[model samples]
Structure formats: C-alpha cells, structure tokens
Target: MTATASPTHDAGARAALIAELKRSAPHEAAMRIGLEPPARAAEVLAEMNPAMVQDILEAIDAEARSRIAMAAPRELAAQWSRNAAYAEGTLGRLMDPPFATFRPGSTVGEAIENLKSLVRTAFVTYGYVTDPEGRLLGLVTMRDLLFNDHGTKLSEVMLKDPFALTPDLPVSDAMRLTLNRHFPVYPVKDEAGVLVGLVRGSTMFEEEAFEIAAQPGAMVGIEKEERIATPLFGSFKFRHPWLLINLITAFAAGGVVALFQGTVDKFVILATFLPVLAGQSGNTGCQALAVTVRGITLGDIPPGGASRLMAKEFLLGLLNGAVTGVLTGVAMFVLASSQDSPSAVMLGVVVCLAMMGSCAISGISGAIVPLTLKRLGADPATASSIVVTTATDVASMGLLLGLAAVLIR
Candidate 1:
C-alpha cells in the first residue's frame, strides 16, 4: 500500500465537500484552511466529479480559473493561479494574495484589533509586520497577540525578520525545510524584501503528496493524496529533452549490435543466449544506477564524494556481475553446449567477462552523469534517469555484441 492510495475511505464526504464548493467558491474556503486554490482543486478532483469541478471553477476568480485550465482539470482555482501570471513554484502561485500587513510602529492593541476585524478576510498563521513603505519588518503569530503587552510596539512582539522563502526556490526544497522546522506557516518574499503572503504547511504537504504520486513507483504507503502540484507542462519539457538524449545514445548500442551481424548470422547458437546475458546485465546495471542516483539526489553522497560513490558502485557491480555471470554460464553449459566442444568453453567465458564489464561501466556511468549534471546546475532528478539508462543500455548491448563477435567468430 503506497502513501498515494486514492482518498477512497472518505470518498463520500469529499465528494459532498466538492459538490458544496462547486456551488460556491472553493478558493475562499480553501484559504481559511491554508490551502492554495490549485491544491483545493486537486483534492476536489480526486472525487472524480465533473459537476463539482464545474461549480468550483465557476466560483473562483477568472485568473485562478485560467491557471487551473493549464493543469487540464480547469477547476476555478486552477484558472486563478494561471491568470495571476505567477511562475510555477513562485510565492505568487503558492500564496493567497491580499493578505494582511501591519505597520511596525502600531501598538500591540492596534495590531490585535486589526487582526480581529480582518480575521475573516486574511489568513492568520503569520501576521505580516511591515514598515510604512510595506517592506517587511517582522511577523506575529496568534500566540504573540495574546501574550504581549498592549502598549508595546507591534515590532516588539513580532518575530524580527522572520524566516521567509523566496518566490523562486523550488517547492520541494521549501517543503523539506518547512517539514523539518515545523513552522505553521512561512512568509514568501520578493527580492526587494517585501512580504508577499504566507505558505501554510498543510498546503505544502498536500502539494508535495501530489507531486510524489506522479513518479513511477514512488508511493510511500499513504492515502488521501496521490498526485502533486509539479508544473505539468514544465515537467514534460524537462523529461522530453532527456528522452531525446537517450534516443541519440541508444544508436551507439545499435551500432555495436550491427558490428556483430556476421557473427550472429554464422552461429545461430549464440543468438539464443545473447538475450539472457544482455537482460541480466541490463538489470544489474539499472540497480546500481538507481542506487547511486538516489544517494546523490538525497544528499547522502558527501562533498568530495565521487571516489567513494564510484568505489561502492563498482564493488556492488562486481559482486552482482560475478554471481549472475556464473549462473548464466552454468545454465548455458548444461542446457545448450557439450563438455567436449571448445565453443562451449568460449561461450561461457564470454558471458562471464561481458557481465563483469557491463556492470562496472553501468555503475561508473550512473554515478558520473548525475554528479556532472548537478555540478552544471541542472536538476539531477530530471536528467539522472535518462543518463543512467542510456549508459546501461549502451554498455549492456555493447558487451553482449562484442562478446558474441569474439567467441562466435
């Protein structure tokens, strides 16, 4: 059971909520609970109710609706995010606008009264304390409001220059930081240091939960959230280019296979076992690649860590290669070839040698490509899959073909 199981148990209530929101504006209700409009749309959409989808869209602002449209579900809140012209992962995309802000010089009493009056309109997780020019000065939680002396300046009780996220940092990083810190909410700021609005933890978690659901086999055994708020079109853009790169690299392997065409045509016996060697080698390569890429992405691979990573992968590859190679050699010898035939001996040696070589190359290439991309300021996650798989595919094919050429010819 993955963490991404559909929110099926509460399906009925969620459906009713979606229906209610569709008839009304879900955005306003979501704001009270500290959810972005797009996130709200995703939650409602999980019910798979089209009528509710329509109603939600109708209730949201036109701009929000437009952004939601970009997501393909086109609920009203989604459109609002699009229309705001905020780039994906920006504070503008993730925050509720028109949030409350207070002057630093204001009395605690004045600030408290202001919060009380505007509580219905603005989110109260992190009250914005600003200078006259609207530059951020500090933040005040609701607890600060109750405990503070009334005569004190708003600046006194408010957190001075509270921790804030830039509009442009990746949401994944922000979410990780937020989870570790356990802040109820954090402010988002522009380069000029003006407070934009707050990003609530609930919103970040829901968005992350959805994002994790999009990857192949990324479920962590939770329910209620399946997909996350990754930029769908942007992800397509990132993924497509890598796939194209893989396509180009694939030709190298194809060329190697072409080299052994004569050998394959002469001894059809080699052809039958070729797939076994290639498939097993490919699987082993992929295992190493996956582990290395994961370690690198998670920051578990240390600074000046290439040698250590490479050594670990190499040793693992060697072990896997030796085991699989022996099994393959034994199987081929017993099933296909006679003990008296020199060709049987040659074939067995070829499989073992090829397996070892393929595993080593796969491990090395897997660690190298992702680390290189990370150094170049490219996203390691997006590029790692393409690079590692291409290396494994090319290496596996080349090893098998080269072995066939030598042993069969």
Candidate 2:
C-alpha cells in the first residue's frame, strides 16, 4: 500500500504556500498554486486575502475554479458562489461571510462567551448585532464589550446606524465612500437594505490598487489577469491578438503615406520631418490619454466632463505645439536652405503650422477616445493607446504632407 503524507508534512507545505500567496499578486498566486491538487489549492486560497481569493478564482479556468470550489470548506464555497452572483468590479465579489454576529437582546457576557470560540477560528473584528429577520441593527467593538457591565445588552452599547456599503457598488465608488471611514470592516447590504456580508477595508483598497495597476497594461491590450509570473504560453495567448490588431491599424497610417507618395517624391526633406511631426503629436496625445484614464479610474471625472477635458487638452496642445513649432521651423529652414530647395522659407512656415494643428487634433482624439469607450460600456484603457497612436499618426502625417502639397511648390 502507498503511504500518505504525514499531517506535519502537509501542514508545513500548506504554511509555505500561504507565505507564497502573501508575497504574490492574486494573478501570480493563481499561477503558482495552479500546479497544486485541487484540495491543496483550495486550502491555500481559503487562507488568502478575501479580495485576492476572488481574483485568484477568476484568474483560473472554469474547470479548475469549479474543482477548487468543490474542495473548499462549505462556508467558503458558499461565499464564492454568492460572490459570483454579483457583477465584476463590485463589492459583492470581494466580501467575506460575516462572523461573530449576535442578536440585539444578547448581553455583553453572552457575546463574550460566544467570541471565545469565534476567535479560535476567525479573526473577528467587531460583533455585529442583527434583527431576528437578519437585518443589521448595529455593531459593538471589543472596547464596548470590555468596558460595559456584563449585564449590558448589545443594543445599549452598539453604535447605531453604522456606515455600510452596498453589495453592487462599484469598487471605484466604494473607495470614494470609504475614503473617510477607514474602518477595518464595513457591512454590505442588498437593494432591500438587509445585511448580507462584510468587506475588509484592506481588501477593498487592494482591489482598487490592482485595478489601477492593470490599466497601463490594458492600454496596450494586455489582460488584467496576466502577470509577470504567468506561464509563457498563457502570456502569449493573452497578448498575440492585440498585436495583430495593432499591425492592422498600422497599415492605415502606411496607406496615408502611400496617398502622399507624389509629395514625398517631389520634396524628400518632408520625409525626414514626417517622423518628427508624428512623434511630437503622439507625445502630446499620450499626455492627454494618461490624464483621462486616471480620471476615469479614480471616478474623478464628473458626468459631461469630456467636452471640457477635450477643450482643455486642445488649448494646451496648441500652446505647447506653438513653442515646439518655432524650433522645428528653424530646423526645417536650415535643412531646406542647405539642400537649396526653392521652397525653404515656405517649408519652414508649413512645418510650424502643421505641428500646431496636428498636436491640437491629436489631443482632442486622445481625450475623446477613452471617454467614448467609457460611454460605450467598455474599459476606458482597453487598447486606448493603439487608437490614440493611430489617430496621431494619420493626423500628423496628413497635416504635414497635405499642407506641403497645397502651399509649397
């Protein structure tokens, strides 16, 4: 008969996995623990951060997720299933089963007696009081339990109408609501205002941080669940399609150049400056793009703020482009004068005007693209850079060559 591992050995292995999970991001933790048997993986996930548990579960596949859930404790498995009932990026997905609850009529001594056993299993923060119907009444801190008379009922000591979060509240909105509260835990209620679960402040903050951190990658078409420690094939699978999309968009810019083939054939100097114009406008657009994405992520942008943002970026771009344009104009004049092109002075004017116009339009596009995506119920950061870059390229190149074709010769 094959011998099973000793209890001590299994405990040590599980302790090590917990340590590893603590050190890795949720996605990385999923990758690391994915090789474990379902039973082992479920045990490790159970001991993880509540918010991280949801993310790790999401990062794994449906078969694996189901297997891990099956192996998990009944309470945790139920919480996972309940969490799945809510939409992504909502507080419901990151909640934990409330522990240490008591009826309002319970005495301090009775609550203390119950906590003795509760503390042995879970890290209870506060004792929640609820109605017989399961609606939240209030909560009592450990301090209240310590200072109050043993005969004191929870209703006499608990803080009334304690701040709570709604289950369906967006994580971004949750962050805003809890910014001032900072309590270790907040009660979660449903649309009917019945208490259902508790979310830890740390877990909520970590989820928000992960969402923010994933955005820069999202702008380039990388999935939020991908991590540096992800399997090579997994990373390739997540990334390859976006790159193909980028290649297709690049051809649009290439076609614009093809349209200007005659202008380039006549004045080769314009070719040298094409990249310069595109690069400058692209940088301007990226500045606007970064700000817009951050605003959306933090819920900083007010409703109908897009038009004001676009106008602000456009003006900022016009002023910045003018300052850069003077220097670019001088460079063009010198390069053209050296080449003895008859349109040297005129070429300088064209460069200056093209730079200013290209940057202004690029800025508007950058701000508008993300705002449009957000309005369409898509991620504001999803491949936004690709869209902004393509717009900048076509606009910058078109403005420069188009102006030359019209005004120069």
Candidate 3:
C-alpha cells in the first residue's frame, strides 16, 4: 500500500505553496488558493499585505467572495468589510473583534476560566463586562481578576464607566484622548451604545503616526494611498494634478512680477530681494499651516472656536513679522548702501514694511486655508501647501515691488 500523507502535512504543504504563489504571482491566484477553504480565507488574507488585500478581495468573483465572507467569522468579516463601510481615517477601521468580554453577572472564577482558554489563542489584556443588550458597563483588568476572590461577581469588581470610543470617531481624535489617559485596549461602541469591538491603543498610535508622517507629502499633492509598490502610471496619476496646480500658481507669481517690471528695471537691487522676501514669507506660512493642521486633527480647535485660533495665529504672525522685519530691513539697508543706491534708507524702510505685511498675511493665510477647507468638508491637508505658497508668493511679490515702485520713486 502507498503511504498516505497526514492531513497536517498536506495542509502545511498547501499553505507553503499558497504563500509562495502570493509572493510570485498576481494576488488573484493566491486568493483562489485561499478560496479553497473559505473558512480559513480571512486568516490567510489577514496575514498578507494589508495595503493590497482590499484590492485583491475586490478582484475575486462576486459569488466566490460572498461565499468566503459568509464562511468567515463575523468579526473577521466585519473587519474586512470596514474598508467599504467607514471613512478611511476613522476608528472603526482600526478596531478588532478578537477581544475577551463577559456578562456583568459572571463570577471572577468563570471569567478567569474563560480567559484561560482565550489567552492561549488571543491577546487578553482586559475583561469587558457588558449588560444583556451588549451595552458596555465596565472593564476588569487581568491584575484585578488575579488578585480578587474567585467567588466575587465581575459586576461588583469591574471599573464602571470606563473610557470608550465611538465607531465613527476619527482616529486622530481618538489618539488625542489617549495622550493623557493611556489604556492598552479601548472598547468601541456603535450608535446604540452597544459594544461592537475594541481598538488597541498601540495600533491607533501606529496608524496616526503614519498619517502624520504622510501629511507633508499630502500637502504637496501626493496621495496617501500611493505606496512604494504603486505602479509607475499610478504614481504619475497621483502626482500630476499637484504639479499642474503648482505650475498655475507659479504663473500667477510671474504675473505679479511682470506688473512690477518697470520698478525692477529702475532699481535692479529690488529684484535681488524678491526671492528673499517670498522665501521668508513662505516659511512663515508653512509653520502656521503645520500648527493649524495639527490642532484641527487633534480636536484642539473646537467648532465656533476657529475665530479664536485664527486670532491667535494672526497675532503670532504680526509679532514674528515685526521681529524678523527689523533684522531684514537692516540687512537691506546695508546691502543697498554698499551698492551706493541713492535711496538706501528709503529702500530699507520699504523692505521693512513689506516684510511685516507679507509675514502677517502669510500667517493668516496658513491658518485660514486649512480651517476653511475643514468647514467646507474637504480634507485640510489636500494640496494646502500649494494654495498657501501661491498666496504668500503673490502677496510678497506684490507688496515688495509695489512698495519699491511707490517709495523708491
């Protein structure tokens, strides 16, 4: 009789072959292998690259995908389906259902027994106590369960009214809540206040950190979904729009300079300082934009309080402008004097006034652009740098050259 391969050996060999196919072939082929055992497909997909898993799932045939979804565990299906249901940056996508929970009436001994079994397969940090309707009541830490009497009721020992996150809350807002109150796991609730899942604080932190790191690129018009593995054409499509916008803005700045061509020719020295003024003002605007975006993301700037925030940024702009303006004026005075310009002192005064005005406007523009976008229901970081830079460039050039035309003449 021919020797038979054990079920374990056969499964292991199948898994190995599927993994190799996943690495070497299109995701559809690997997904077909996963489809063979629909019940295990969720686990296999979870282990694969999450960045591409959603696309892979979409590529599968509708009937096969539906069968796999039906066969998978409810929580696993929910997690996989979250991409379609929730907005990309919400807390729902970061939550998982693989958590330890118990009824409020369960005894400490029973909870411990349940945990013992779950601990072997899942990460068990806290025991959630919920009411009959699955509304969360409290939490019991592992340490509490260990130290309490085995006969104690979980309801009597649990910490009531613990911090929880709603499913629709943005992940950035969720992260701000954890800055002062750190918990390993936070319960997630639906609109009805029933506990739906749990979000790991570490996971939220990682996702938020990645988002924050990507903000600079996002400001420059890079898509958040574009990864190193993105195809060449994909990257080109993602990047072209921003470049076109930047080009248009550049032309606007050039138009401002063309309007001041007469002044630039009369006082060639003024031409030398245009870039200096624009660069300084652009940097100042970017600083304010960074702070405002961070504040908006963290929920620090509440609704109806944007005016106050804008006022603060505006005041900061004026103060920073005055300080930097005086120094810049002195440098312009010295440079013009060395060049023996007849209107050296007047040129210094013109530069000082221009710097102050440009810096002030840049600061206000930075804060206002993001806040306005948020109010209009657009992404605060979507090509904001392009807009703000264009504004500062136009303002700086218009002020500097216009002033030179008036004051130097």
Candidate 4:
C-alpha cells in the first residue's frame, strides 16, 4: 500500500495534521503519525503536549495502542507501569499486557465466533491458539479460519513450537534472538511456562532504533541486537579512574625525573624537550589504544583471540611509532638548533625511541584490558577506556622520562 503524507515542514504542521486526522479516523492517524521521520518523531514526542497523546491513546483500540506504544516515549510506558525501571531492562516491560488467546482444543468455529464479536484488525490474528497449560500454540491466520470447517480443532493445524521468550530476559537479548531467528511474535513466558505475552519481532526492532537514538554511545550490531553501550560508557567513564591510577603509576616515572633533576638543573635546555617527548609519546600511545579499543568492541577480534589481537596492535604501534618518531625527531632537531649542544641530537633520539616504546605498550594494554574485564564477568566496555587511557598516560611519562635519564643525562 502507498504510504501517507507526513509533516515534512514544521512541528506545528504535523501536530495540527495529526490532531485533525485523529478526529475522523484515529487508527489511520496513528499509523500516519509513526511514519514521520524519526528526527521529527522524537522532537514532536518530546515537546508535544501529553493531553494529545492521551486523546490518541483513548481513540484507538488495543492493536492500535500497541502500535502507538512502539513510538511513544519510553517514559510514558514507564509511568503507566508506575516504575521507571520497568522499561529499563526488558521487552516484557514494553509489551501490551493481557493479549487475546484461546485453548488449542477450541474449534475453529468457536474461535471465529469470538473473533466476530471483536473489532476486525483490533486483534493480531484469529488463530491465536494456546496450549492446554495456556502457553501459545501458534497463530491461526484469518484466511485459515475463514476457509476451514467451523468444527476443526485449532490443535490439528496449529504450527507447533512457535517463537518465544521469557519475561525476565533483557530486551537486548530478545531483539538478538528475534533477529537471528527471524520470527514475528516471540511468545514470552513466566518461569512456570505460562504465556505472559508475545513480543512482536517488528516492534522489538523499532524499540531498538528508539533506544539507539535516546541512549548516548549505544551501539547495536548489524548482525544482532546485543547492546554494546557498556563498552562505550565503560571506556569513557573508567577513563578518569584509569588516569588517577596512572597518576600513581606516574610517580615511578617521576622518580626517574627526580634522578635527572641535577642534570636538568645544570642544563635547563633538557627541560624544554621533556614535555615534547612526553607529548609525542602520549599521542602515539593514544592512537594505538583507540584502534585496539574500536577493533575489540566491533568483534573484529574474536573472543579468546587476545594474543592475535595483541600482535596486530603491536604491529600498528610500531608503524605509528616509526612514522611519528621520524617526523618528531626531525622537528625537534631543527627547533633546538640554536641550543648549540650535541645533547640536542641525543634528546631527539630519546623522544623518538620513547614514543615507539610507549606506543607498543599502549597497543598491547588496549587489547588485554578489555579482554580481561570481559573474562572476569566485569563489562569490558566499562573498563577498557579507563585502563587504556591511564596506561597511555603512565606509559607516555615512563617512556619519555626513562629515555631522558638513560640517554640525555
């Protein structure tokens, strides 16, 4: 079917259009409302008055309510349930409760009679068959119901072993299961196997898109719906802690600085090049760390394949080091030419070597930290950024200062 016209120009125009359209045909209006591009959807939903949402919800039947629910702000559903956490964890929290169902033994005639009393298209389908224990048996399509003899049993023709999930499972998990298996309604059950609800695979997909927009740094894979925000946040949040820890580690490098303090005091020129070496090392290490983190999160590095990944990161570090070292060394040599000291050449060499060593260490740490966190039941995302950033900081100082003490002094 052809799609409906959406408000492409202004928020007020879309809202006005939706309001007028709902008055005449609310279901059509509901579908049209969702069809607007997502940017408009969030903006409209965020700022649009709540009274209008209530009006639209009141005008529609259950099926339409479910559709509207898919697009409605998550906070709206959370309020309906009276618990913000309700929408936080699982697809079951987002599902429309008390959906229509019938026993498997029920005759097609009986099912039709029940369906006839209900509004057409209000329910998902007529073949909504249930097992003896009230578990979903299979969908009985409307076509099948209309053609079959009234007395035919639903169990006789019902598709067995339909797609399903449990209530307590996370929405991320549900989305992954549905996408991988490619089913429509994933029946959700309780611990006792009692069917609580069905998660529409289509709706699940839509919710994920909504989530990706709302949550900062959230990323869902192309192949599955496993939420990867932990790593992003982990990398960002833990970075400070890692920096603090690296501060403690930096003292070791600082001790090296202390050892060379007399030499630096005698030849103050060494102090000028110190920051340059440290800065170059920091830059190289950060570059290597970023690559390692991105690769691990994208699953380009297989789980348990840390060694292989480490080798790759180390190689990248070496390449980055060689190119950056030459440029930085040459730049330092030219910049310090007026110093008239052979120590200037030695300082440049120290920086170049230190940068290469620091980069290699950062790359190896970048790969190892996330893998170690993941293995220990801690989220790798949370820990990777912190560990890598701090490691880079400490390694940067360590390499620069150690080289200064060994060579420049």
Candidate 5:
C-alpha cells in the first residue's frame, strides 16, 4: 500500500521540485515534468529557452515527444513543430500558432465564449478570423467582440484586409516590418494565404534581442547557437577556424613588411610608423564595415543601393583620410626635423599621400567585403572582421613602405 500526500502537500512538492530542476537540471527536469500532463509540460517549457526546449524534445523518445506534442495546445504544438522544422533565422521559427481563431461566420457570442476558454490556458491578444478553407480574412480584437452585438457575424465586426507574413520571410525582414507600427500580434499565412500562425510583438522583440546580442560574437566567428552552457569542445570547434584564419592573414601582413625590408633598414623610423598607419586605416575599415552590415541587416539598403552606399563611404573616407593624414604628416615632419634628416619634408609628403590612399582603399574594402560575401550566399558577419582587418593591414603597410622607398630614398 502506498501513502498518499494531501493535495496541498503534493502541490508544494511539485513546485519545489520544478524550482530546483529549473535551477540545475533544466533539461532532465523538463523531460520528467513534461511527461506528467501535456498542459503542465507546455506551461513549464514555455518559460524555458525555445532552443533548449526543442533540443529536449528531440532527445526524448519519439513516443514521449509525440505525447507531449499532443498534450500541448493545438496551435502551440503546431507552431512549435513548424518552427523546429525551419532554419534558425527564418520568420517561421519566430512565429507561434494562432491561439485564438474563428471562422468568418462565427457569431460574436460564440467568439466570446471561445476566447473566454482560451484566455485561461494561453495568451489571447487578438482573434484571427478565417474562411472555411482556413484562408485568413481579418482580425477581431477582444474589445471588438465585447462592444458588438452578440448576434453579429465575425466578418462584419473584424478589421478587413489584415497584414500577414508568409512562413518563408526572413526574421530580419519581418523585424523591418514591425518597426513603424507595433501591433500586439501579426498573422502569419502560408504562401497560399492560409492562416498558419501569429507573431507576437513580445516574441519578435526577444528574437531580435538575441540576434543583436549575437552579432559581436558572430563578427569574431562565434556560432550564434553558442552560449555559456555550451560544451567546452563545442566552443573550441566554433573558435579554432577563425583563429587559424587570423594567423594566415597576419602572415600576409608580415609578408608585405618583408617585401619592403630595404625601406625599413634605411629609415628605421618608417618601421615605427607602420603600426600607426595600420591602426588608422584598420579603424576606418571597421567603421565602414559596421555601418554596411547594419544597413544590410535592417533592409535599409535596397536592391541596386550597394553602389550608392559604396560611393558614400568612399567619399567619407577620402574626407576623413585627408584630415587625419595632414595631422600624421605634420607629426612625421617634426620627428624627422628633430633627427636632422635630409628628406624630412619629402618623408612628410610620402606619409601624407600614403595615409590618404590607404584610408580610401580600406574604406572601399570594408564596404565591399560583406556585400561580396552576401552575394556568394555566405553570412555577411561570418569572418568579416578577419578579412577587413587583413585588407587594411596590407594596404596601409604596403602603401606607406612602397611610397617611402620611392620618394624618401
């Protein structure tokens, strides 16, 4: 015979267990608790990371996973499974199944009763009105349902010609749409215009936050999926390739310096300025790269806009380079005069010209690298810094040294 605890004791024990599991054994605890009741499991899993939830679901036995899926709300389960099937950054992965939906003919009284039931179990922001074939027609808010006559049909009261996103839309593109007017929820339809899901503003906000947060790491070759909880080996695998690439680029910069060995030997001061030139040009390239990447991500740069963007960056680079180069040239002149060098004025001219040219080239390289990579179907942010840095280093050092050899010697 088993001793049974009172309802209060059972509730307390379950809460305590859930709290402990959430802190330490999130995956295991989710699996164990998710098996108890479908609604309860969905509720618990909803609060956890979506990626982790999907991982746990995939790792569990098929039978168990199926049961949990079945136990979840119809729309919630459908959305979760659909999102799992999509690539990480697509809009499909960011949308949830429409929790509250009604047919065009549904009466106001029926819609209200349905919402009353759904509100208890899940979030109910707006009720989607669909046709008999599941094609999205319009939307009805709770306020509309409450203020209207009870016998009124949904089509008569709902907002017509609603905005909808297709499943294949990129998450970044979806974000662009939400910037102006933030709706509480936006409908998602299939390519055929059949209603499939809802994208909550809150959910989209969270995904955008994650994407923005991941960018710094992404620029340095870190995988977007990597987190503090990622395994040591996983992190190693993600990081090693970028490090090796950096080493190769560093060698290329060194080789440029090696080619100008005579210039460095004749004027050791040129070697001292090599790093200063590289630093300025490299920062200029990075600034261009950052702005270009942002423009691409936000959909601000439309088709055929790349040429204009490049031109703008190049002109800005020229202006900035001229100003900075004059300052550097003055400094070099003062240094050379202090050393009583015969070619002090010529050295200043060479340095000034080299700085201007290097900066202009760096800016162009920065703007083009990401755009080129994007055209080649690669991620714009992936390894972009490495390529930009390498280009700037080679350009700045090669120009400064080669010019010094010709003009100063």
Candidate 6:
C-alpha cells in the first residue's frame, strides 16, 4: 500500500495486467487485479478505465486505496475518482483532470512558469482560463502563449467561448460533434458550464472504435468481451449461451416450415424455391440491419427517425425484390415447363409475388430488431442477426408455401 514508484517494473506484466483489467467485467474482476501488489499501482490504474479504477479503489481496503492514490500525482488520482461517478459510456468516464489553469488576469509569464512545473508528471496540452468558480471562459494555445509578450494577460490571448463537450454526452454523440474539429484535447463541462475535466481525442476515438469493432460479433450473439487474445475457455464461456439462443431461434423458423408439410409434399417443386426465397429475404434483412446499426453507432439517427429509417429500408427492399424476382420467376417457369406441369405460368407468378412480399417484411424486421433491443435496454446489435434471420426465414418459406396452398390448391 505504501510502495513508492520504483524505477524497475516488468513492462510485459504491466501491459498484460492492463489488458485483463480492460477485459474484466463489473469492475469486480478489476478489483481483484487492482489489489495485486504492482510496483506502481497508481500508474497501472491510470492506464485503465477511470470508472473501473474508481470502483476498484472504492472496493478495496480504504488504507490501501489512499496509500496507492498517494503514490500518484494528486491530479490523476483525483480525476479518476471524479470520472468514476459518470456512467461507463459517457464522456465523463474518459476525462483526465485539467491540471494546468490560470485566472483571466494572469500574465503569460506566470502561465509559462506554472506549466514548467506541471509538465513533469503529466502531459500539459493546453492552458485553461477559468473564472474563480471554475466556469470555463477560454483556451490559451501553446503557440499563443509563446508568441505573445510575457506581459499580455491570458484574457487577451485566449480563444473565447471555446467549444466544450458536456460530461453526460454519449461517446457516439461526442464523436459526431468532434469529427471535423479534430482538436488534440477537448474540455468537458457540467450542465452549469463549469469546467470539470479534459478528454484526449485519441482516448475518445479509441473507446468508440472498440465498440464499433465489437458490433459484428454482437450482431450474432457473440459477447462483446471475447477478443482474439481471449483464452479458449473464456471464449467458450462467452459464446456458448449465444449459440444456444441462435439454435432456439432457428427451431422457430423450422417449425414454420413443418407446419405446412402437406403443402410442400403436394408440390415438390415448392421445396426448391423455399431456400432461394429464404436466402434472398435474409440477405435483404441483413443489409438493412447493417445500415441501421451504423446509423445508431454514428449518432446519425435523429429523434423520431426510426420510422423514416425503416421506411427507407422497406422501399429499397421492395425495389430490389421486384428486380430479383423476375430472374427467379423465369427460372421457375423453365423448371415447371420441363416437368410438363399444368400451372407453370401461375407457379412463376406466385414465386415473384412471394419474393416481393417476403422481402418487404424482412427489410422491416432488420430495422425493428435492433431498434427494439435498444429500447429494451439491451445492446442494439446483440443477437440482432439471429432475430432478423428467424423473421425472414419464417416469412419467406411461409409466404411461398401459403400462397401456393391458397391460389394453386
């Protein structure tokens, strides 16, 4: 608990520890590793999630926590503590404390002198100008600091009413706002516009990138925690449940086909088109799903935008279905004529109509599945592919068989 920052520590070990801490769930896993007697607990903790660090520190022995915190420079420990109070996915969770600041009346010489000491343990990117109550007024760039005369007051040189991110802003929303600005660091403010902390562009982007990367796996029921580096047993533990759920959904699709066994038996050729229809419908749904997920991830979906998104996807599916249907219908007609069937023309027409209808439903399912999951407070992409696949399969096979049963029977 009282260990100082020793010069010698294992780099590999520290990195492994940090990776495990990041991969850990509920911060409890982090707490166990946090209690490990690393040579520099504070520094190791600093490299990890602030929210996790805060939870781990709070869970451990108070004496140990305080001593470990004391080992780090005051600014970092304090910042991590404050950042923990925010939710895991918000900007506040990623902020570092604003260590270098000066009052409006402070001269450039005074700011430079203070930064001389501040840069030793921390990276000083920009100097902040704030009122006595910590309301952010402006930002003083390093170039402005050096070029201007030492006698110039901070108020005169600083950029007034600087752009800032609110702590509660979701990382996706933050990314949308800052995509073009590309500033090295952004100051974070509370609802009252009081400067609270700073978020590095690198850190913010990296966090969002991890979420975006996890989306592919999440779509098919893969747990977000599984990574290429994950242990075999751990990967199995993460994936087994989702695979089971996917199987269950698959059975639902199968059941729909089974219910119309008589229809399929009477018209053996119907079996041929079932898979084709199902595959086409499933692909259409997947396309819609991908776009909708991307929109949500990038914060492109506006308020009450769900209906518009679904409608757009539906129209695209309708157009695509009609085009692909003509080719499929021609194939159906050729097969039926070779068999000398009486209803060749009608069979082809049924296939075309079924394609259009199934695709329309599939496209809408794609948008609805993820949107519904998000509304239910689950990850938007989690098991979404499974749900959409089931919906499309049932619609495709059921529609093709049902239409033939009614019109041809």
- Candidate whose TM-score is highest: 2
C-alpha positional error of residue 176 in candidate 6 after TM-score superposition, expressed in Å: 1.7
Q: Which of candidates 1 and 6 reaches a greater lDDT?
A: 6
Which residue pairs show collisions in model 3?
A: none
Q: What is the lDDT of residue 126 in candidate 2?
A: 90
Q: What's the C-alpha lDDT at position 225 in model 1?
A: 17
lDDT of 5 at 306: 98
Model 1 misplacement above 4 A: 1-92, 217-255, 306-308, 372-387, 407-409
Listed per model in order, the count of residue pairs whose N, CA or C atoms clash below 3 Å is: 24, 0, 0, 6, 0, 0
Best by lDDT: 2
lDDT by residue (85-131, candidate 2, tens digit) is 88888999888888788999999999999999889878899989999
Give the 10-residue window scoring lowest on summed lDDT in candidate 6: 25-34
- Note the Cα lDDT for every prediction shown: 0.61, 0.89, 0.81, 0.58, 0.81, 0.85
Residue-wise C-alpha lDDT for candidate 5, range 1-409, written one tens digit per residue = 9999998997686676556444433345545765577666666656554544665666667777787788776766776888788666677766666778899889999998887778887777899888888899999988998899999999999999788888787778888887887898889898888987777777777777877877777777887766665557867887998899899999999999999999888988887778888999999998999998888888889899999989988888777889999999999999999999888898888888888988888898889998998899877887788898999899989999999988875
Could you estimate the TM-score for every candidate? 0.68, 0.92, 0.80, 0.60, 0.86, 0.88
RMSD per prediction, one decimal?
9.5, 2.8, 4.8, 10.5, 4.0, 3.5
lDDT-best of 5 and 6: 6
Model 6 Cα displacement at 231 (Å)? 2.1
Task: Evaluate model 1: give its lDDT.
Answer: 0.61
Query: What does the lDDT read for residue 388 in candidate 6?
Result: 93
Mark the regions of model 6 whose C-alpha exceeds 4 Å error after superposition. Answer: 1-32, 48-70
* Tens digits of lDDT, candidate 4, 202-242: 66666555444432222111211122432455445534554
